[model samples]
Target: MTPPLEITPLPYHEDPLGYFAVLRDRPGAVLLDSGRPTAPGGRYDILSCDPLALLEVDGAGRVHGDPALAGLSPFAAQQALLDRLSREVPESDLPFLGGLIGYWSYDLGQRLEPVAGQARPAVTLPASRVGLYDWALIQDHDRRESWLVGSAARRDEVLAWLSAAARPAEAFRLTAPFAAELSREEYLARFHAVQAYIRAGDCYQINLAQRFSAPYAGDLWAAYRRLRKATPTPYAGYQAWTGPEGERAILSLSPERFLECRDGRVETRPIKGTRPRGATPTEDRRLAAELEASLKDRAENVMITDLLRNDLGRVCRPGSVRVPTLCGLESYANVHHLVSVITGELAADKRPMDLLAAAFPGGSITGAPKVRAMQIIDELEPSRRSAYCGSLGYVDVRGRMDTSIAIRSVVAEAGRLHLWGGGGLVADSKGDEEYAETLDKIRHLMNALATPTNDDKWNKKDLHLVDRDIDIQ
Candidate 1:
C-alpha cells in the first residue's frame, strides 16, 4: 500500500525560485513554473525533487530504466511502470501532486512514426525522460497560497531540506557569444526547398529552424534566472537530470501551451504567427494588430488548428473536437503571436499517454499533414531537434497533464548551450521576412545571456562571434 499525501499550508512566495534554489542540487529536482511574476494569466506553480523511479528512452528506441521493462515499447513501458506507482492518494485541487515530470525530445517522434534516417543526430540525448515522484510543493498564485503535497513523513523530509541553508553557486557566464551554425545562404537554400515542396503539394506549411550554440561555464541555474527575467512566459519550466555525459539541464521560457488534459477535458493552444514587439506602446499595438489581421498568418494558424483538431480526434471521443478560438492575438514580452485554441474530450478508454503519443511533437511546430512535413524537415534541417519543439510538463497520477511547446528554451550540456529559433513557412512567405523572423524569435534570449548578471562585467575579448557554414543537405 502507498502512503497518502497530506496538504500543509506554508508562506506564499510570489517567486518559487527561492524554494527551488534549496532543492536544485539534489538529483532529479524539477520545477514547472507558471510565470506569474512577469507573465499574465498564470495560475499555479509546481515544484518537486528526488523521484522514486526514472524512465528514459534512448535514440535507438530502446527503453532504459527498470531492468524488467527493457524490451517493452517506450509508451507501453511508461504506461505499465507509471500505473504501478500510481496509487490512491489524498485528493487535491492542485494540478500536480506527484507523478511523472520531464521532457519528450522532438526526435522522439521517430519512434512513434517511420520518419527517420534524414536528419543527422548532431545533439545526442534521450528521446524521452520522466521521473516518478512521491511528493510535490504546489503554489496557487491566484489564491496567494502554498501547500506541501506529500505523505506526512515526506513532508517532514522536504521541510528539513528546504530549511537548510542554500549553498552558494558561482555566477554563470557565456565564455563566447552565441553563433549560428547555418549561414544566410544555407537558410535561403532551405527556404527555397520548402517553397518548392509546398508548390508540389507535398506539404502546406513547414516549420524551419536554425541552431545557435555558445560555450559557457559556471552555474546554469543563474543563467536560467537571467533568461526568465528577460522573457517570462506562463509555461516556463526548469528540469535537470544526470545523463551519460554528466549533468544536462533544460531551461524553458515558453509562451505556447502544447496540451492540457484535466478531468477528461483536453485543450491545446497552438501559436503559429509571430511579430516582434515594437519599441513603443503604439508600435506594439500596431504590430499586434498587424499579426491579428495578416491573411498569411491567419491561414497558417488555421491550418495548424485543423491539424491539431484531427490529432485530438484520434484519441478523443467522437464529435468532441472543436476549435473555439482562431487567430487570437496574444502579446508577450518579446513578440506578438497569433494563437488558436482547440478543445476536445478524451475517450473513456484512453489514457493521457495515449493522447500524448497521438500528438507528440505538436502540429503547429511540424506544419499541416504532420508526418510528411516532419520528413521534409528532417531532410532539410542539419541537426536533430533534441528538445526544441518537444513537450515539457507533467502527467500526474490523477490523469491531469499540462505541457508547453519547448520554444524560447535552452539546453545546457557538456559546457555548451544550445538554442533554436524557427517559424512556419508557407507558399507566400518571403525569404527575407522568413529569415528575419527566425532570428527575431530568439534574438532577445541571446542578448539577455550576453548581459552580465551582477557587478561582474563581460570581457569584450570573450564575446567574439563565430559563424560556420553547415551544408547538411
Candidate 2:
C-alpha cells in the first residue's frame, strides 16, 4: 500500500530558495538547506525532485544504482536500498518524508577503514551519491509553515512545478583566482608531518587541510546563492548529480552537526575550536572570548568530544553514550567555533545504517583516533576529499536523520571549483599558527569566490563579516 504521504498546505518561502528554484532542472535535485535565508539557522527546509533511485558509490567500493545493489557495501547499499523503499508515514513532523538524500564522500571513508591507497586521487567523483526521495518539500522556518509531502498525484505534480515562474541563474563567475594547492614549503612540510605524528604518540588529533582551486563558469545555482549569502549555515546543502565527471555539484555551507537521528534519539555536534571573526565589536568579543577561554581550544574540544563519545559507543544503548556539550561557543559567518554536544540511545538492534556504519568520516573531521585520524588524513592531504570532510544530510523514511560536517563545503566538478579549509592538530600545534589556521578557515570563502592574483599572497588581508550571535546549540 505505500500511499499515505499527503500533507499539503503551501506558500512559505522564508527562502527555501524559492522552492528550490523550481525543482532545479529535475532528475534528483535536492536542497536540505536551513540557512533560513541568511542565518538564525535551521528549523526545516528539505526540498526534493525526481528521484526514484540513483545510488552511485565507486572508488572501488563499487555499487552503482541497483541491480539489487550489486553485492552490497556502501553502507550495505544504503541499508539495502533503504529497505526496499515504500514506507508511508506522513502525519507530519517533517524531517525528510522522503528517504535518502545525497553525498558521503570524504572518500567514502576509504570504503570503511584501511585508508585505501592513501590519498591524491584528485576527484573523479562518486564515493557516495544518494537520492531515493518519494517526495518532499517541507519548509517550516519556525512555523511560517509550508508542507507538500506526496501523493495526491505527487501533490498535483509538485504543485504544477511550484507554480512555474522563478528563473534567474547565470551570474556565478570566478573563472580563476583561488590557487593554493599547498606551498608555503608545502604547508610547512605537512605541518611538520602533523607535528611528527604528535611526537610519536602517533595521533592525538590530526585534521589539517588546505586546497582552494578555481576556474568556474556559471550557476552552481548561482554559486549556491553566493554562498548562502556569504555564510549562513545550520548544516546547509545543495546537491545536483550526474557524475563520471560532468555536471557535479555539492555546494554545502555546513556549520557542523554531523549526525542527528531523532525519535530513537541520537545527536552529535563536534566542531573543534577555531576563531576568525573579529574585525571589531570589540574585536568580536575578543574572538568569542578567546574561543571561550582556550586551554588549547579546550584540548581541541575535548579531543573531539571524547572521539564522539567513542563513536557513539559503537551502536549506542548500553550506558547510551553522553557528553552533553563540552567546549561550547558557536558563532559563525567567518569563524568562531568550539561546539560539542553528544547524546545517544539508538540500539534496539541498531540501524540508521547502524549509525551510518558507526559514524562515517566525522570525529570533527577525522581527528583523535578515527581510524588513525583517517590514516593521518590520507598521509597529509593534497587532493582527494572529494566532498570535503563528507556527510551531507537526510535519511528519513520516518526513522529520521540529519547530517553536515562537509565543512563550509563546495565541490562543483569538471569545470573546477573545489575549496576546503581545516583544523585540529594538537601537540601545541603552531606552524605559523597552524598555517594561519588553514587560511583562516577558507578566508571568507576565498573572499567570496574571486579577487586575488598578482601573485595572490592569500589575498593580502581584507575579509570581514561578523555580527555574531548564532549559537546553533
Candidate 3:
C-alpha cells in the first residue's frame, strides 16, 4: 500500500513584520490583505474590521491584502489600489505579480508616477509556453522561491510591541468619507462593453458589475441600525474596532468568505450563485430551494468547488481532501447564495505561503478552468480588479490565519468610486437579466455612496431579472 502523504513538517518562526518586510522588497506584486499587529502589545492578530486591511491583493491573481507598509488614507484609495492589484492578474502567464504603489486617491483620474529608476515593463512582449503543470511556482521553504525570513526572533518582537500598544480613545474619527459612487452613463457603457467582451471571448461565464449612490451620512452606529433594519444579509454584521492610529465604522455588511486556517488545517468556503430574499417566509424558502435545484447555478457552484478542492489538495496531506457539502443554499440579507465547503488537513511541512500558493485568486471569484476564466475576466471587465477578488484576513505570529473572499465589497478612487457585482453566467443565463443581477449587487452600495435621499430625484434602481430589465432612466 502507498504510504499516506507524509508532509515532512515545516518548522516556522514568527515575527509581526518578520518575512513581510522581506516580501515588501520583492518586485511587481501588490500586497493585499495586510495582517495587523494587534493592540495590548502589537501582538499578531486578525484585523478583518480594519477598513484598510479590507483592501485586496491583485498579485498574479493570488489576491492577498497588500500589507500596509505605509500610512493611512484620507480618500478613495480603495479602487486605485485594486486597479494596481488587477495588473497582477495578467502576469500569472509571465508568472509574476509585482511592481505596485498600493496607494489610494481622492481626486478622480489622479495618477501615480512610477518610482524613479523602476524598470518600465513592456506590455505584450515575449510570450513563452511553459508546460501547463510546469508554469505553477513550487513553494517550499528552501525553494523560498520568494521571501522566507528565519528564526523566532520576529515572533518575540511582536509580543513586546503588543505589550506596549495600549491607549483609550473617546470615539473614532474619519480621516475621509467612505460612501461614494459613479455616474449612470459610465456604468452602463462599461457593462455593455463587458457583455460584448465576454461573448466575443466565447466565455461560458462572466460576472459583470457597476456602481450606484445616494450616500446616507449618519453615525456608523446609526448607519448600522438602518442597514440591518432596511436590509439584512447572512454575511452582514456590525463590528466595532479601533486601530493603531484610531478610526472605526459599522462595516455594515459583507457577504463573502476568504480563508480560515486553524490548528493543523485550512479551509476556504466559496460563495458562487445568489438570489434576493422574499417578503414572505414561503417565498424565501422557495428562493433558496430553487437555487439548490438550479442546474445552472449548481454547475457554477461545482466548478468553483472543484477548483478550490484542487487548490487545497496542493497544500494538504495525501488522502486528506474532502467536500463535506456542495450546492448548499445559504441565504443572506440582500441575497441568497449557493455555498460549497471544502476542507483538508495541512501537511505538517506546509507553510502559510504554501496554503496561499495553492489557492491564489480564489476559485469562487474566478471561473474554471481558473486560468482561462481569469483571462476572460481581464478581457471582460472595464478595469483591473485591484481588491474585488483578493482576500482580507488576519495571520498571527503562530501562523494561524483566516481570510475572506473580497466580494460585495467596494473600492474607491478619488471621489469617483468603482465597485463590481455579478452572478455566474451559464448556458441558460439570459443576455439582459444577467445585467440586472449585477445591479442588484450594487443596490446597498449605491445607497451608501451618494448624499442622503430626501430629494425626489432619487429613485430606487430596481432590476427585473425575469424580463431582463433595468430601471435606471
Best by lDDT: 1
TM-score of each: 0.96, 0.36, 0.55
User: What does candidate 3's lDDT look like per residue over 129-148, in tens digits?
Assistant: 00000011112222222221
- Per-candidate clash tally: 0, 0, 45
The whole-model C-alpha lDDT of candidate 2 against the native structure comes to 0.79
Whose TM-score is greatest here? 1
Provide the lDDT at 449 for model 1.
77
Ten-residue segment with the worst summed lDDT in candidate 1? 464-473
> What is the Å distance of residue 452 in model 3 from its true position?
4.0
User: How high is the CA lDDT of each candidate model?
Assistant: 0.87, 0.79, 0.43
After TM-score superposition, the amount by which residue 305's alpha carbon in candidate 1 deviates from its true location, in angstroms, is 0.1
Residue pairs with colliding backbones in model 1 are none
Give the candidates in order of lDDT, highest first.
Answer: 1, 2, 3
Q: After superposition, how far is residue 259 of candidate 2 from its true place, in Å?
A: 6.2
Candidate 2: Cα lDDT at 419: 73
Candidate 3 lowest-lDDT run of ten: 125-134
TM-score of model 1 vs. true structure: 0.96
